[model samples]
Target: MSAGTQRMRAAVWYGAKDVRIAEMDIPAAGRGEVLIEVAFSGICGSDLHEYADGPHAIPVAEPHPASGARAPLVLGHEFCGTVVELGPSVTGLTRGDRVAVEPNYRCGRCPRCRAGEYNICRHFGFAGLMGNGGMAEYAAVPAYMAHRLPENVSLEQAALFEPASVALHALRRAGTTPGTVMVVGLGPVGLLTVRLAAEREVPRIVAVDVSPARLHRASALGATDLIDARLGEGVGERIRELTGGEGVDVAFEVVGSESTLRTCLDATRRGGRVVLVGLAQEMSLDSFALVNNEQSIIASVGYRDTYPELIRLVAERGLDLTPLVTSTIALDTLVPDGFEALLDGPGDQIKILVDLAARSDRLGSPEASAGTRRVRPQPGGGEPETSE
Candidate 1:
């Protein structure tokens, strides 16, 4: 590498439970792409899935068609950063601009992309998992995948745009109307659903979760009723009770479990819609109520084009996402303080951000101008796990 060129550090995923911090040349912005210096990268459920039970969304043996890259992937999808460079033919963005990444890369010729439902494009691929990602000090991404962040949205909170947009898309998929709504499971997506639903002025919003800390956060985010899933059999009853026995107008199942799906069905009135936002492989359901009661089951994936509006919501509508981030760590400490802490489970952590510039920022050093640097995993940090 030339002395003028800088080497970047990244959290590279070799396989499930195997992520390493290695040094690499800073990526160059390709045609119709931009090079981003990542500010904050969030450890998403999908990242956790890769760490816990992965090679699921991430490509392993072969390269993905859309991303055209395979294993030893740089793993991170939800993140925000500054545009450090722009490539040929790219427009509407300049260097030094702050932005959040949508991360969804689609084949434009696909049916879904042509129909404006690109989230479900036949060749759908994610940047972080399928290709180069923001876990590193820098990443070069297609311009379409980048959305400018508003001035009011902090770089830290900008990391939340992707997840919050997922919640917004779930609401859109559910065709959420102004009425009673219940969001089951207070994970990041569920909590954001509650917050967005409140912003949309849903008359009654209910949040359900087993975590008291999450429930408290939900209440603070504007959920009118809180149901503890620990209450077991009585959970659905309490939801129905809060809705005056007729049940909710719309029920969102953010926890994609058999019981949570059942709770969604039982808590919605006849002919109401039930939206499934959580990532669950298989779920069992009662056919009688599903068919007889005429409940509509809607499944939501990542997101469509919800970023611009979400940015506007944050900038103009007073949407507060500050509470979502419970912890922040440096890139070198991602495994111990970021991923492992989240994996240790049932803790008070809602969202953890890996500040790519944390160490460099503190030292007043130009991260990209620095030469190659490598950071190996800690003793217990690299042991592979068998779950997702």
Candidate 2:
């Protein structure tokens, strides 16, 4: 079939709370790009933010400097797929190669990009947010963004590599070691933080969250202490109590709220570091306390050159990521079952994946038999008892 005539289903973002599953012409892989048949696309916190209150990153008034993509585009960055076609000049990849999409777009000439820190490029944008993304039957992404996966890592597990990279990058940015650490959010990234910190054998891991289920999950993932934020007890004070008044050597604020930011700052020791991993807008800071404590606040954005190492961690090191994936749904139910589900019951779900193949089977497509499948989390080490 001709590319222009081939129609694919996509979840297009029009505006806040307005995402339509429409049939659009399949995109052709341009120079240095690859066309992929999307397997699974996971709903991200950023996607939820865009759904709740946005145009935050989706450019509407003007074109983004990097991807030059605007709204009315597909909305998914965390995804994995199989290569269907290779674009001109694309090398080192071939058809049938299973890969995870990195989805980051940056201007190569930017100062940060030139300095090997493309994650914070001056004209930084993401493929799913700024342009077309993987929330469709097929997506064409830059070849460099596609990281070939190991045979052991299922596509469903690979779908989570993006957020896992975020957690890994945050931990690396904080220079985490065998020390007391506090994670002030029990979302996917926060839970992943606990898991990775446990892998690193951080001596004391304090997990703070409002949900008892999430806190229990943290404990199973290796948190030494759990603090319930819903009880109205001061998180900072509780953290202090857990640390015997010395405060944690490092803290991670993953909630992206003013109060959580303050809690992280107050929970950190005098010379400790607080890594800001969440996206927030116009938050007030306690400058006096910050100065008095001589504490450092380090901000970590999207990952850079992390896919290779992350792949090894999962493939070679036996690092299990299935615990973070709480449920999976078809693309047609993305709004209600994926977006609205996360918003309505934020504590109950961690990651909701859109199984394109399930929808394909329902549509009775020729590829239905060969549709992508989900890998169940193996028993032990914080794996949830049940998943859809």
Regions of candidate 2 where Cα sits further than 4 Å from its true position: 1-5, 176-178, 360-388
TM-scores of all candidate predictions against the true structure: 0.91, 0.90
* Model 2 TM-score, 2 decimals: 0.90
lDDT of 2 by residue, 98-215 (tens): 9999999877897888999999988888888998999999999989899999899889889988898899899999983848999999899999899989988998899999999999
Q: lDDT at 386 for candidate 1?
A: 26
Candidate 1 matches the true fold with a TM-score of 0.91
**Model 1 stretches with alpha carbons more than 4 Å out:** 1-5, 360-388
Would you list the C-alpha lDDT of every candidate in the order shown?
0.84, 0.85
Scored by lDDT, model 2 comes in at: 0.85
lDDT of 1 by residue, 1-388 (tens): 2366587878888766667677666888889999998888888888988887787888888889998998877988988899989899999999889998999998899888999989999989889989978898898889998888778877877899889988999899877374899999898999999999998988899898899999999999999998889988788888888878989988888887989998888889998999988778888888987899998998898898898898888889878887888988887667666777788856799888888887733322333222212444344646333221
